[model samples]
Target: MKKLTTALSLVAVMAISTQAATLEERVKALEEQNTVLTEEVLASQSAGFTLVDSEKTFNGMGPAASKVYFSDNPLSIGGYGEMFYANPDNGDDFADVYRFITYFGYKFNDWVVLNAEIEFEHGANADKGGEVVVEFLYLDFLLSNEFSLRAGHVLVPMGLINLRHEPTLFNTVQRPEIERQLIPSTWHENGVLAYGRFDDLGIEYTAGIVNALNVNNSKTTTPKTGWIRSGRLGSSKNASFEPAFVGRVDYTGVNGLIMGASAYYGEGSNLKNDDANDVDGLTTAMFDIHARYENGPLAAYGLYTQTTLDGAEKLSSNAAEKASGYYGNISYDLGGLLGVEYKMPVFAQYENYNPVEKTVDGQNEDAFETETVTIGFNFFPTKQTVIKVDYEMNDVNSQETNTLSVGLGFIF
Candidate 1:
């Protein structure tokens, strides 16, 4: 229980939605919350009951991303979605409706608030074709429990799947490719976020500035320096306000543990050439470290990431200024360690990525070095759904990419 509380029904559904609705009104508000919020599934479903979401957390954040910091009905809503299916041994198979997201919030009293998230991918068609986005929008201010204030379009807390990527709090169904390619999962921008907590040194923090990352798109590779996940500019309208600074710090003082570290610095040529800052001194820096553990029924995690860049050898010549990766995992539940009753978890993961780890003017793509291994299982018949099967082995560069997957994920 990562308890950091606040009242008012303790909103929490699970996040990223509400970019102004209209995907059939966000799938009719998640089919009317399966009959209005009573369908709540994020907390109780028995079996090793661990806090998932929809219980109430603000500093621990959850439920459509903190549900306006626990609003008391000044309006709050939530959403989540996932879908997957694959089969391959070189047979080329596919199935995906990949994502659907929703979230909206508002609270105007106890110190102003508003929130948003809306996404639809590979499944939405009408509003100008699949892949809609808006992943975050913000406004927050509360000056207690250690301070707070957030401003528009954030989500750059760095890692743990970029501010809790929902899906019942992780256990694989894709994610963790060194945090999706050198620390870039669901990376958002457009500035300002600040968080706080200390409470006798239990420690907690998050910092942000946002926007900044262009990484000179050399049309995608060959000196693009693997451009940090293709320089996710997120909202893109010829953006580049040039600002980027991210941060994180966590400790959770033992008991179920969480240890963290994160960092980012930026100036990756978002301005498309405003006098080259004198021929591209582009700029970038990244770092990461993580650990998590959940007691009972056993769970474990680990991560490490790195990136560095500067000018990228004047843009090509094989440009790569470094990149890195790491991953780890462990899971166990077996229905709360076998007293039976349901809920099973079994997992294994390993990763080592390199997206071009060191080059500054050519020669470094030994096929972009990679390795991955995943073994999984998760079954929850209730508790807001989960049924996933996984087996993956990848070794890129030396080729070989086996796959077999099945999935379903949910949160409400």
Candidate 2:
């Protein structure tokens, strides 16, 4: 809600600083702030939203999203940016500011908190066709580690990228296409969320009810045409009373490793299970499981997701029966293994997906099936910043294309 780039400029100084004393001073201030935050959070426990040392995120949420939960200071400002140069064999070469994002958090005492994300894409120029979007705005009422509540436009805990899309967290210059077209990263809706963790068993969970997707909009045939991404309400159209439920669970018993599975279920559009309406059991269901292992010099991760639409074929001309995709990556830190001065890891990723895996027979459709292989390396001048370069080979719906790119990403 606040255009605070200028304000961010003041805080940005700390990220770009090279002086040791400045870093030390910042750390000391951060520690003092934490001490105060803990005390206030504890004192406010009478309202049912306090936990000692609550600063730690039991669930795998991004650093920015979790900032307000335990901040002694009322406001927390941080951001990340990615700028890149891309050269495609089949297209022109260009350089662009791919993403500029800012995270703003405010703690209105311990029981209530506000978190938001403002995103600027492609340089944020109207002439150049750039745009800005309020990616997320949510409020959390912390009850305890075992139970808490969140409302407003909240992110769906469905895919890895949806929560941890910070560039440095992934290997390639771009996120996996499957996560984009299939799961639709950055997916959020008007809803309330319930999340908590059973720390004794290393189990974390979240359940929520949100506005259901508008798959049957008459103006756009996205639903009748079997397009999934366009169905997201996104706070644009009047959110239909039809609601969806999401549930997720994560197991983090092993140190430096996490495994999770989640599901989404809802009525497809406004279609009901009424035979008189000629649409029965037209429900949409999605399931996914993912795992990540990052310990020592080796890293490995993978995700598999699939969706099914019951009675969809009878409701839409281009409805799909099933859609699925999966991706995996493995990397090892050769620099560390070789005792090099800097840390660099060579990584490779493979993705296979079909946006419309199985559509209604006899209906015309674009499968949007694709496979990709990417090889890249990341160099860290500091723990918070990374320089990345990679080559991607795309098997686009059976066609071949190649691209090479280099970029920088930093978090503070």
Candidate 3:
């Protein structure tokens, strides 16, 4: 009986020891879990605080990328560049190109802003004379949502792309001759302008005054007329800073569509001419229409411009004859092929230009006419970078020559 009792006591002690050991293990596990939970809570709180502060600070800056100063108020800087390659069917070779621009903008307040852009062409190489040009320098004053005033060097807003066309913004490798000759793309001079929109009526308008055109750049197709015509029309002369009239009217409510009509009338002067008074004043005018529809990865666009020169008979004997030119282009984009994430934009464009109007003294003068068509594809691996390939066809009216070109271009 004594042996049995001793055995029972030993079993009881073992059972109690096992129970205590299990309790200790559970407490240790619970403590470890609590430590992990505490750490997670601390981390989450820290992140939340950081996000709130960041939001507040961002909001306080008031949509500014740069600071304000006394002379220059709120300023912002942005620009882009492109490189290209070309192989012309006419045997002319163009390879590895570069064009760059930098723009600086200052906003005085909600109503006024100043913008300037400096451009560099052909890689800024000394071999190309390193053409450094000011593309635009202007001040804009917003009087109301429906009306604004602008002045200084201003773009002649005749063609669709003349004012807004940038390498990255355009789908093709080059602009059409029609635009170059008819409306003179990238043309700007000293001028003042007014523009605005009426949201209730869905109408927008732009108008401006600028310097006039010169005889050398006039685009008259006929040759028999004198070269000394009064193509110098628009605003005033260089010495006087003549002002030309330019403006446009637009409609913008058709679901992602922008359609507009534009016009320009101006006069110009010749400072270097010995017989300045004899040179006829240019009576110049242009008319154009453009439209764009874009949504997501798809886009469509078209533009046409026609220009005429009058008052040539009023000029002296040494001037040019009556001259005129017109241009048109159309394009579309097809987004992503092969079910890939990348955006594949394919487009085609046409351009024509007649630079010189009539020759001098019976000599076969330059009746410069150029026509070009381009089909290209742009691959956007990312939002900020584009790789482009294009095939271009050129038909020179004077030379009766044709060329084929292929090139690569990019922007960032």
Candidate 4:
């Protein structure tokens, strides 16, 4: 009977031990769940996102990642830069590695924006003499989708590329000649611009005073090669005016296209030391029209610009002479022609221009005309990076020249 009692005692002890083990496991699991919940709470608090107990859904993060964030108002940041190598193949052997352009910009509230573009030709050093320019420093006020005002350094909106020529944004190695010569690509001066979008008519008008022409013969004169030096300065005849009025108009959102016209007219900005010499004064006007079509993977664009000058004493004196120039450019894109997708974007583009038309002082020889044609393909591994290969033929009214360019262009 004593042995039976001891056996019952052992059985009771086993039951109590099993129950204790099960209770300990349940407590451990509850503790682990609490730890996980604490960790999740901490993470959510630090990350600035709400912690939800339900399923997760994908959110729109594309714009945020791209630096194009949307708040009560939309804002975007974008810019591009390029480095290039050129072989003229003319036996003259001219090669340059340069920083094309760098731009930083901000857009605020739909009606106000800021943009600054800096250019480094060889490198960012003073001896190389790179230029620091304010491409556009202005405030834009939008009364409505149809009416707005822009004041500051306004671009001379006369060509197709001038308004949208980010290095990675364009397919060609360089801008077309017509845009470079006739319309003066990258042309901007101090002024206020008025623009609006009305239904199918996208209209733009600008009138502002700007530094007048520099007719200083000593400053603008160059050698007999007809390469008219750099076009950064104005004529000497109207040095005193220092400013002139400019304007433009554009039509957009029409059936499959966009078109525009522009005009610039102003008195000379320079002053003459000798009034009797008769500084005939200077006046310039540019007219242009453009059209483009883009849908899906295909795109095409074309434009023509003509520039004219009048009022000069003669080709030699601080007097302006009658000179005119014109150019045209067109480009078309063919979607990945070989099924290469991002590896290949075939394109064909052509440009021709006669930038300088005045005769050499005393020599009575006219400036040579410049024309360029480019055919190439682009490889875009991503939206921000591109590899370009192009063959260009640059012809002058006096000679023939060509260049082959292949390079990588990107933005970060």
- What total of clashing residue pairs does each candidate reach? 10, 2, 33, 22
* Model 3 lDDT per residue over 245-292, tens place: 777888886777878888877653433444545345566666777887
Evaluate residue 9 in candidate 4 and report its C-alpha lDDT on the 0 to 100 scale.
Answer: 99
- What lDDT would each prediction earn against the true structure? 0.75, 0.77, 0.58, 0.54
What is the Cα-based TM-score of model 2? 0.80
Per-candidate TM equals 0.35, 0.80, 0.69, 0.68
Residues 202-296, candidate 4, lDDT per residue (tens digit)? 45444455554444344233322212223324222233445655656666556555566666665532444656543455555556666666555
- Which segments of model 1 are wrong by more than 4 Å? 1-64, 73-106, 109-137, 140-150, 156-167, 173-175, 186-188, 192-210, 214-267, 270-313, 321-341, 345-354, 357-362, 378-412
Worst 10 residues of 1 by lDDT: 8-17
| Residue 279 C-alpha lDDT in model 3 | 46
Question: What would the per-residue lDDT of candidate 2 be over residues 133-173, giving only the tens digit for each residue?
Answer: 77778888889989999898888888788888777778888
User: Which segments of candidate 4 are over 4 A away from where they belong?
Assistant: 1-77, 92-97, 100-102, 106-110, 200-208, 215-241, 271-280, 295-298, 314-336, 358-367
lDDT winner: 2
| lDDT tens readout by residue for model 1, 314-395 | 7766667778878888989899567777778898988887867777644755657888888988887876678888888888
Better of 2 and 4 by TM-score: 2
Arranged by TM-score, best first: 2, 3, 4, 1
